[model samples]
Target chain A: MAKATSSAPPAGSHAAAPINQSLTPDDKIGLYRLMSRIRRFEQVSLQHYQGGKMAGFLHLYIGQESVAVGTISLLGENDHVITAYRDHAHALAVGMGMDECMAELFGKATGCSKGKGGSMHYFEPSKNYWGGHGIVAGQTPLGLGLAYGLKFKKLKGAALCYLGDGAVNQGAFHESLNLAALWSLPVIYIIENNGYSMGTSQSRSSAYPSCLAERAAGYDMDWELFSGEDIYEVRARTQVAIERAHTLSRPAVLEIATYRWEGHSVADANKEKYRTKEEVERFKNEHDPIQRWKRVLIEEGIASEEDLKKIDKEAQKEAEASGDFAKASPYPTPESIFEDVYWEVDNKTDAGQTGRHFFND
Target chain B: MPRRLSYRHALREAFDEELARDPMVVLMGEEVAQYNGAYKVTEGLWDKWGDDRIVDTPISEAGFIGMGIGASMLGVRPVMELMFWSFYTVAWDQIVNNAAMVRYMSGGKINCPIVIRGPANGGTGVGATHSHTPENILANFPGMKCVCPSNAYDAKGLMKAAIRDNDPVMFMESTKLYGEEWDVPSNDELPDGELFIPLGVADVKREGSDITLIAHGRAVITCLKAAEILEAEHGISAEVVDIRTIRPLDEETILESVAKTHRAIYVEENKPFCGVGAQIAYMIQSTIFDELDAPVLRINSLDAPAIYSPPLEAIQLPTPEVVVEKALSIC
Candidate 1:
C-alpha cells in the first residue's frame, strides 16, 4: 500500500512523489461510504426507471460518482453551485436529501423543484444550488453572473459551475470566460470530460482534444487538470482552484477526466457499439473508482470486508426507503402548474412589470 | 413651475442626475465622453464626472456592449450608447441573448439593469445603414422594455425611469428631435418622487375629433406637423397620439382615440409590412372594428431598405407631406 503524503512535491522534482496513495483510515471509510451511497442511489434510480416508477430522461452519474462527491465535499454550504442537465449526482452531493431528489425524479409534489423542473431543471435555492440548466453551455453566463453578484454583494463566497466538455464549444462559454476573466469574478468552471457528448466522442466533437485547460489560456485564467477517477486528486485540485477563486476574486478552470459506465441516457443500452467491450472492461477493472477506493481502504486498515458489506447494505436500504417515499408521494396538483414558474411576494411585483405592481391586481 | 429645455439637454440632465444618485452608474460609448457625445447629449459629463463614470470605449460595439452586460451583472448600471440604431447589429448577441434572456433563463435569479440609448430613424442625410430605424426588431424580444421618447419631458422622465428600473431598457432617442425644445414641468407637476412616465401609455399631443394620428419616436413630430397642415388647409382636425413605449403598447389609449375620432391614421418610420403601424392597425381593427368610419390608414416607409441616395431615402420614409396626403386620402 502506498502511504499518503502531507505535502506534494513539485511535478519535475528529482524525487517525484508517487501518484497513488492510501488515504487515512477515516478518510478511506468516508470515501467508501460516499461512493457506495452514490453508486447504490444511481442503481436504484435506474431500477425505478425500468419499473416505470421514475419519469423523464434520467442521466445517471454511475461511473463519475467520485468527481461529484470528492469536489463537493471540499465546498462549504455558503458557496454557490451550478451545473448542466447531467445533474442528479451534483444535487445529491450538495446535501439534497435522497427522498427529495428521488421524488423529483418521480415527478411528485415533494420534489426539490416541486416536480415542476423534472430531471433537467432541478433547483434548490436554499442549498445555493442554482439550477440544472438543459441548454448546452447556457449556464456559463448565468454562473458568471452569480459570481458577479457575489462580488457586487461584497460576499466572500465563490461559485462552482460544472459543465460537460461538449458545452465548451458554445459561444456563451467563450463569452463568459472572457467576461469573467476581464472582471476578475470569483468563479471556478469545472468541465466534466466524460469523453462523449450524447454519442459523439470528444475527439470527433472538439478540435483540440488535449485538455480544456489549454483553452483557458486564451482568457488568461489559471487552470489545471485532474484524474476524475481519483477522488483525492479531484478534491485536492478543486480545493486549490476554489481557494484561488475566493482569495483573488478571479476565475479558474479544472478539467476532470472521467468516464460514464451507463449510456448517456436511460434510452441508450450499454451495447459497447461506440467502443470495444475490452476497452470498457479495461476501465471497469483497472480504474473502477469504487473498487480502487475499497482496495485502498483494505491496505490502509480503514475497513474490513465486513465493514464495506455493512456500508453497502445501509446504502441499498436507504435507497430503497427513498424510492418507497417517492412512490408514495402524490403527483403535482393541477393548480401547482401555475405556481413557482415565477416567484411571487406578498405585495411586490416581479421585476418584469412595466409599472403596475404584481400583487396590486 | 415649468422650464423650457431642448430634448438633447433633458436627456443629458437625466444621465447627470442618475449618475449623481448612484455611484455604480457609468456611461460608455464612442465619443460620448471626450467628443461630447455623438450629438452633444453628453457635452459636460466628461469634465464633471471624469473618466470613471463617463467612459469612452473603442469602436468594438460587440466588445463594449458585452462589457456593459458584464458590468451590469457586477452591480453597475451601465448606460450604453450605440451612436445609431443601425449599428446595433454588431452587438445584437450581447443585447438579445445575454442582456435580455439572462434574467429569464436564469429563472429570475438575476436582473440586467442596463440601458441602451441610441438615435433611430432617418431625417438626417446620414443615409442607408446610419438612417434606418430598428425599434421593431428590438421590441420583438420578450424580456426587453422598448422606449422611444419624442419630446423633452418624456425624454427626461423615461430616461430616469429606465435607469432606476430593474430590467434592461432599450431607450431610443430620435436624432432629429434632439434640438426640438419643450416645456419640462418642475418637481411639483411630476408624478410622485419616482417621476416615471409609465411605459405603454400614449401621450395626447394634440386633441381633435376628425381623425386619430398615431405615431412614435421621430414619426410623432411628422404626425403633429401633418395634423397642423391638415387643420390649416383641409379643415381636417386630427388628434395626434405619441406612443412612447412600444412593447406593452398603449392599445387602450389608441382605441379610445379611434373610438372618439371614428378614423385612424398610423404612421411609422419602419417598413410598411408588419411595422408598428400594422400592429396599431390590427389592434384598432380587432377592438374598435365597428367604431372606425374608414379602414385604419397606415403610412410607413417603403418595403425596401433605406437607400443611400437622398431621393430614394425620402421615398422610403414617410415625411410630413406623405402623412398629410395619407390623412387627407383616408378622410
Candidate 2:
C-alpha cells in the first residue's frame, strides 16, 4: 500500500525525512520527464524483445521507475551508481544516452559497450556508473569497493548500489554488509524489493522478521523501509542516507517497496502463474509510481494535464528514435571480437607486443 | 653485485618496491597486515606501509577479492593475496568472471589492473583441498595473465611485472620453493636499474642437445634436478626451459628448444589431464610435429586428488627421479 499524499505522517514517523520543498518548478517537471523517459524506454525495449528483434534477457523497469529516478536525482558529481540486471532505468537516470543503450541491446558497434556487453553489462566510467552486473549480489562488493576508493582518496562521495529483493539473501550481500560496516565505507545498499526474485515470492525466498533492510541491524548499520510509489518520498528518504554516507563515511541499507508490471524478465513465461492477475491489476491501478507522480505534479500546480501528456508523448518519440538508431547502427566486425580484451593490447604497449594475447591471433 | 636471496624475500621486495613506486598499489588479504601474512611473505610490510596500503581483511575471499577488483576499476592497483591459491574457488566469480572479463565486457572502457598472488602447489603436506595448482584453469580464460615463477630471480622479476601490468595477473608461487635461495641481481646491477623480467618470456636454465624439458613454477626446479641426474649418470643432455608466464606462453622459446633438442617432455606439478603441460604438449605436436624425434611426453603429478600422506604426496608430485624416468623413455 505505497500511497503518497500531502497529508502523510510527519518527518519523524517511520524514520522518514522531510522533502526538499525548495525545488524549482523546472526540477519537479524534470523528475517527471526523467521517469517518463525511463518508462517509455523500457516499454520500447520490451516491445522489441517481444518482436524477436532483441536477444538475451530483458528485465523491464516499468513500474519501478520512481526508485531509480528519485534516488539518482540526489547524486552529486563525485557520487557513483551500480546496479543489478534491471539497469536501464538507472543507466537513463545517470544520463547515458538512450541511443547507445538501445544500440547495446541491438549488439551494434555504436553501443555504449561497443557491442561487447549486452544488456547485463553496461558501464559508463565517465558518468561513474560502474556497471549493470549479471550475477546475483555480485555487484555488492564492487559497490563497496567504489566507496572504498572514494574513502581511500579522501573524497567526499558515496556509491549507491541497487539490488532486488531476492539478492538480499545472498552470501556475497551479507559479506559486503560486514565489510561496509567494518570499514565504514560510504555505500548505500538500495534494495528494490519488488516482492519476487524471478518467480519466487519474497516470503518463499527470504527469511525476515518484518522487511529485508532491517538485516542491516546485524552489521550495526542504519536502515529504512519505504514506499517507491511517491517520488517525493523516495527523494526525501534517500537524501538522508546519502547525506549520512557523504558526511560520516557510514553505510546504510534502503529497501524501497515497489512492484513490476511484467514478469521477472521478458523471457519469464510464468509471469501470470507466479502471481494473480488481480494482484497485478491492483498494483498497476493504485501503486503505479508514474501515475501517482503525475497526479502529484498536477495537484501541486507544477504541470497541467496537457503538459504532462506532451512530456509523455515526447518520451515515447525519443524511445522510438533510439530504436531506429539501433537498427541503423552496424554490427561489430567478426575480427573485432579480439578487440577490447586487454587495455595493453588495445593500446599497443610493450607488454602487449610480447605475447599471444588472442588464441586465434 | 649479485646476492643470494630466498624466494619469499624476493616476493616481499617486489611488494615493497611497487608500494613505494605507486601510491595506488595496495595489498589486501586475511592476516596480511598486522599478522605479517599467513606465510610471512608480507612480514615487515604492515609496519612499513601502515594501514592504508597494507590491509588485513576478514576471512571473506569472495567479498574482499571482489572489493579489490572493484577498487582496481577506479584507478587502484590492488594486489590481493590468497593464503593458498586453492581458496580461489571460493571467490571464483570474482576472480574468473569479474576480474578476467570486466575489461572485455566493458569494451576496454574499464580495466582491472589487479594481481591475485599466493602459493599454488601440492608438494606440501596441506591435503587435497589446500593443494590445487589452478594455473591451467585460470590460463584457459582470455584477458588473464598467469605467472608461475620457479626461483627467486623469476619470482622477484615476474612479480614486479605483474603488479605493473594493466591486466589481472594471477601470480602463482610455490611454498616448497619460497625459502629456497637463488642469486638475484640488485637493481643497480641491472641495465634498467630494476629487476623487471617481462611476462610471456622463457629462460633456458640449462643448454642441451638430447632432449627439451619444458616446465614452469616448481616443476622447473624438478626438471633442473632431473637434468643433473641425466647428465651425470645417463650421459643424456636434457635442456630445462622455464615458461614463466603460462597464459601468454613463450611458445617461440619452447619451439626453439624443441627444434634444437628434437626430443621434448612437458613437466608440471598439476594433474595430467587438461593441465598446463597438456596444452604445451598439444601446441608442440600440433605445430612442430616434424621437429620432434619422438612423441612429446609429459611427467605430471599423479592424476588424483592430492593425498594426505607425506610419503605418498612426495611421490605423487613430479620429482627428479620421475622426470629422469619419463625423459629416458622419450630420449
Candidate 3:
C-alpha cells in the first residue's frame, strides 16, 4: 500500500513513503524456482568440476541461495548490483542464463565473458550486474562508485554491493564505508557473513563483539543483522534498506547470516581440518535457506509439495542441460586472447589503429 | 600565435576544457579541491567547478582510486589524482588488478576510462618513498597506457587525449617540469580549434644525424639541453626524440630517428633494472642491429634510491652532462 507523504521524511527515518511489502503468488514461486535452479546449477557445476570438465577456482554458492535471490529480487529498474567471487548465485538471480555461466566455468567461447573471466568474473552491464570481482574488498569502493554515479546523475536508485565476512577487515572496506557515509551515497553494503574467511572461522578472523554490521556504527550509518534462512524476511528487510538509500540517499549495512556448505574453494583441502563434519551437517539440516523457504511456501499455501517438486525437477533438468551445453561449447582460440583488451581496440577506433597495442603484434 | 604556458597551467587548461566539454568527467583526489592540489596543479578548479565535480577525497589512495575505476565503468570519466605516483603502491591492487584488468576481464563489455595522473619523478630531494618514477612499472601492463609529457605543449595535448581515450591511461607528470614554461599553441589557433596530441606518437624535439637521445618526461628536457652542448662543443648534432606515450610506444619514430642517426641512447630518471629505457634499448638492438654504428646504450638515474641530500639528488637524476657524455661515447 502506498502512503501519501505530507512532507520529506525526518532525517534518518525509513523511506518517506512506506514500501509495498506484499508478494504475489507468482513472485513467491519465482523466488523458489530461482533458488532451486541455483542450488542445482551449483551442484551440477561442482560435479563437472570434479570430473575435470572445468579448471580454476569454483566458489560454489550452495546453502546461500536465499541471500542473493531475496535481496536482488527487490531491485528496481535503476538499481545495480555488484558482488565478490561467490557470485554465481547473484549472476543467476540477476537473470543470466545458465548456459553462458556454465560455459564460462568450462572456459568456452560462448561463455558470458567469452572464457576470459572464469568462475570469479561474470558481468552483464545491460542487467546492471557489475561483475564478479576476485579481489577481496575491491568491489566495495566500486559499489560506492555505483551509488556515487546514481547520486551524481540525480537518479533515485541504490547500488547493492555484497561482500563476505573476510572482506570486512580489508582497509579498502573501511575506507569505502567512510566515503559512502561522508558523501551520503545511496549504497546498501550486503555483508553475507558465512562464518569463515577461508579456513579461519569468523571468530579467528574478524574481531567483533556482537556482529559485523555493528562496525557500521563507527561510520554513523544504519545497519541490521538477520538470518538468511527465510527468503520473505530477506526481501522485506532488504527492501527497507533499499528504500532508505532511494529516498534519503543514505548508505546502509545489511549483514545476512549465511553459511556455505562447500569448502572455500574446490582446492581448499583444509576445509575438513578447520571445521568438523558435524558442524557443517547441523547448519545444513537446521538452517538450510532452501529447505526453510520450502517449508514457508507450504505453510503459506502458496505452493503444495507437488508444485515445489515440479519446480525442483525442472531446475535439475535445466542444470543438467547447462553442463551438456558447456561440454559442447568450443574453447576460445589462442589468437582471440588479443581481443577485448581495450574498448578502442574492439571498436577499431583511431587509438586502436595507431600503435602496437599487443606485445605479440 | 602559440604562447608560453607553464606545464602546470597547460595541464589545468586540459582539465578545465575537458570538464567543460564532458559532463561525465570529474576530478577527485586528496587536497584536489579546496586545497588546490598538493602541488597547486588544480588551483582555481574547485572554485570554478564546485564541490560536486572537483571533489577532495581523504588520504585513501586505494579507496578513491578504486572508486574512480568503479565510477568509470558506469560511464563517469574520473580523473583520479594521486598526489604522487609513489603513493600508487598503496593502490597498486586497484590500479593493476582492477583498473587494468576490468575491460579485458569483462571481455570488452565494460570500459574503465580513467586517467590516474600525478607527479612521478625522483629529481627532488623528497627521499626514496616520495621520489619514484613508475612509468615503466605502469607501462608494463598491456591494458594500461602510460604517458610522460616533457613540456607544456605535450602535457596539455596528452592530458586531453588521455582523458578522452576509452581506456585506463597512467599519466606520469614531472614535478621538475611543472613550473617550466614552453610554447603551446592556443586551442583557438589550432586547425581543429583544440589541442589533442594523440597517444603513441613521438615528437622530435631537436633533429640531428649524429645520434638519437630518446627520452621522456623530464629526461626529454635533459636531452634537449644535452643536444645543444653536443652541437656547440663536440660538433655532433644529436636528435632528441620524446617518446611521449610509453605503451603503444611510438616505435616508428624512435626507429626512424635511430636509423638516421645510426646511434641511440635511451635516457630516463627511472632505475636501470627493468626500466623503461631497458625495453627501448632492447628494441633498438633487436630491431635495427645493422643500422647502428655503435651498440645502443642507456643513461638512467644512478642505480639507487633517490638520494636525500640536495646536491647529490641533483646529480642522481639524468643531467644534460650525463646525456652528453653517454651520447658522445656512442656517437
lDDT digits (tens) for residues A211-327 of candidate 2: 898888878888888898888888888888898899999999999999999999888999999999999999999889889878877887989999999999999999999999999
Record all residue pairs in model 3 with backbone atoms less than 3 Å apart, i.e. clashing: none
Q: Clashing pairs in model 1?
A: none
| Candidate 1, residue A107: how far the Cα is off, in Å | 5.6
- Candidate 2: segments with Cα more than 4 A from true spot: A1-19
The interface RMSD for candidate 1 is 5.3
lDDT of 3 by residue, B70-108 (tens): 888888999999999999999998899889998877777
Q: TM-score of each candidate?
A: 0.81, 0.97, 0.97
Worst 10 residues of 2 chain B by lDDT: B96-105
The DockQ figures for the candidates are: 0.19, 0.80, 0.78
Candidate 2 or 1, higher TM-score: 2
Candidate 1 wrong stretches, greater than 4 Å: A1-60, A76-78, A97-118, A264-273, A294-299, A303-361, B1-9, B22-142, B175-181, B185-194, B272-274
Give the winner by lDDT: 1 or 2: 2
By DockQ, who's the top model here?
Answer: 2
lDDT value, residue A297 of candidate 1 = 70
In angstroms, how far off is A128's CA in candidate 1? 3.3
Better of 1 and 3 by DockQ: 3
Q: Pick the candidate with the highest lDDT.
A: 2
Off by over 4 Å in 3: A1-21
Instruction: Give model 2's DockQ, 2 decimals.
Output: 0.80
